[model samples]
Target: MRVSRAETTMNYVLLLGFAAFALAPVITILVTAVSAPLGESGGIHLGNFARAWTIGGFGRTLGNSAVVAVIVVTTATALSILAGYAFGTMHFRGATVLFYLFLLGMMIPAEATIIPLFFDLRTLGLTDTYLAIALPQVAQSIAFGTFWLRAQFRALPVSLIEAAALDGAGPLRALVQILVPASRPAIVTMVVLVFMWTWNEFLIALIMAPGGRLRTAPLGLANFQGQYTAETALLAAGAVIVALPTVILFLLLQRHFIRGMLEGVAK
Candidate 1:
């Protein structure tokens, strides 16, 4: 008993250390955001945040980011869950090969695809539009989401699905009422992962939505830095604001994510 107690304490101590390491930079950014003035003032001020907020145009940028993240998360979650079920629970012609092909997108680096995506969007008149950013992110989400959800779906007992079918539940019905509810952890994990990815996504937003007017938070923050020029504190505040949503999302969903990864994948 003493040994077990000692082990648990040590584990917690280690976890706290890891937590600090992860949070240090985030805390630093928060500190910086409130600490200094735009230029020669070099002292703490609340105005830094306000100044960054107004000048950075973060309100519009944050709104744009919120829209994209929400849409991408919902669209990707639904599509990925459906596709994952198809690939995992219901085998169709070319399904295996197609899933692997989707997985191949993971191998191809983002840099390789950005140029082609730009040209394609330019032709389609999607440049500087939310669709321009959202569509590419949707596609990118599939690569990872499919892989993750397929694993979750594949882990379910065949008996559960078969039992539902026997009870007059159609495939769609069973998927919604049975498969999905049973796979809550996996779904939560997928949502969190998708939200975080879409929220933090920088390069695609930068390339696809270059207009300062249409910029997302990260892009807006970058531009804010240039616009303020020497206001490290304000810049840091903007950075913190941009990062907050992702942090809250991860905290909310992290438990389910880890559980799904461990237990859901095992099945």
Candidate 2:
């Protein structure tokens, strides 16, 4: 069936409307962020960024966020790949039960678990540290990562595995040489997603490192906001500073991300 001109026009119009709705606030933020921060002389400039950076202590916060994101993504992806391969290919007793237990992480909300999580971390003397945020986020990322990569791995040709086995390839070699290369797009997509989630995560950061030196970017921005409630331009600048990395990451990896989604959906 062909789409009519009228329908196509309507679809374009609706898409443009949605785009505008989504982009308006972002544009507003960019405009405000670049504009002169309250009473400062001259026209739009980059000084707001400088001020926001200093005021928010973004140097340290961004470093903290980067550290957490790197650790979580690395650890979670590695674990997920192993777990995914196991669930996708290996048939063993109690696998279903264990898989379901992993799925329970997906079913539960972070808010529901955060209280106990904080207590557990505090008891372990990990609060106000990078692991406080990294571990929980890793757990969350692993749950979804396992689910996503399992589907990706499961969709691969069985012949590939059999051929690798016939060639005397160990499971580790098979995963690294055969499966990983083929699953690059899925892995990249997962990394980008997990990075975005971990970077923007606020509640966990706020609770885990409240007033601590190790606060993540989001927490730093929040603290900055409290101190500068009247400084809208500064706030906007700080937000952009905090959010720009994820935006750049998504833009860079959007193709692989979309391909991964399409493959997952198709499978």
Candidate 3:
């Protein structure tokens, strides 16, 4: 079958329209961030970023977010891979129930759990610490990570695992040497998503460690707004500053991310 020229032209038009529609807000944000200040004439004022940085204390807060994201993504991805492999490949009693238990973590919202988490972490003397934010996020990330990787692993060909076994390789060897390498695309996708979620997490970070040295970027931006909302250019610049890392990250790994997602859906 061949697509006619008319149909191809229509497809391109629709795609371009959708692309522009999606990109409109991002273009607006960039323009707003760089536009001349009100009542001032300039090509593109760069001072707004400087002002937002100083006012927002974005240096400290972005560092805090980086730390949390690294810890959460690393810990959660490692744990999820192990758990997903076990649940997807191994035979055991109550496995369905256990997997469902992990799924419950995904079903529950952070808002519903944040209050109790605050008290619990405070009691454990972990509140206002990086761990306070990282722990819950790790748990949350692991839930979805486990679900994602489990589905990916279950879709693997059984003959591959059986071949490894016949060669006298144990489970750990089989996983690390064979399955993990084979599942690179799926794992990269999970890492990217978990990093994005952990980086942008606001509710738990705010509730668990508000107004202290542990304030993440979003919290810092929130506080920045309260003090400097009148400066719209600076505010827009601050938003752009905080969002840049995630955008850069997604752009770098987008191919792997899309491949992983497609693999998950295929399975």
lDDT of 3 at 140: 92
User: Which ranges in model 1 have alpha carbons more than 4 Å from their true place?
Assistant: 1-12, 36-44, 264-267
Error of 3 at 118 (Å): 1.2
Report the lDDT tens digits of candidate 2 across residue range 9-66. 9999999999999999999999988887777876887888998898789999899999
**lDDT-best of 2 and 3:** 2
lDDT of 1 by residue, 1-267 (tens): 256988999999999999999989978887888785734555667777787788888889999999998789888888998889888898778998999898976788888999999999999999998889999889889888898888888888999999998999999999999999999998898888788888888999989976756688888887887787676787888887788888888788888889877785466
TM-score for all predictions? 0.90, 0.95, 0.96
- Candidate with top TM-score is 3
Residue pairs whose backbone atoms clash in candidate 3: none
Question: Candidates 1 and 2: which is better by lDDT?
Answer: 2
C-alpha lDDT of candidate 2 relative to the true structure = 0.91
lDDT of 2 at 214: 87
Error of 1 at 15 (Å): 2.9
lDDT of 3 by residue, 1-267 (tens): 999999999999999999999999888888888877667887898887997898789999999999999999999989999999999999999999999999999999988888988999999999889999999999999999999889888999999899999999999999999999999999999998888888888888888886578999988888888987777777789999999999999999999889888887787
- Model 3 residue-pair collision total: 0
- The list of candidate 3 runs beyond 4 A from truth reads none
lDDT of each: 0.85, 0.91, 0.90
In candidate 1, how many Å is residue 241 off?
0.9
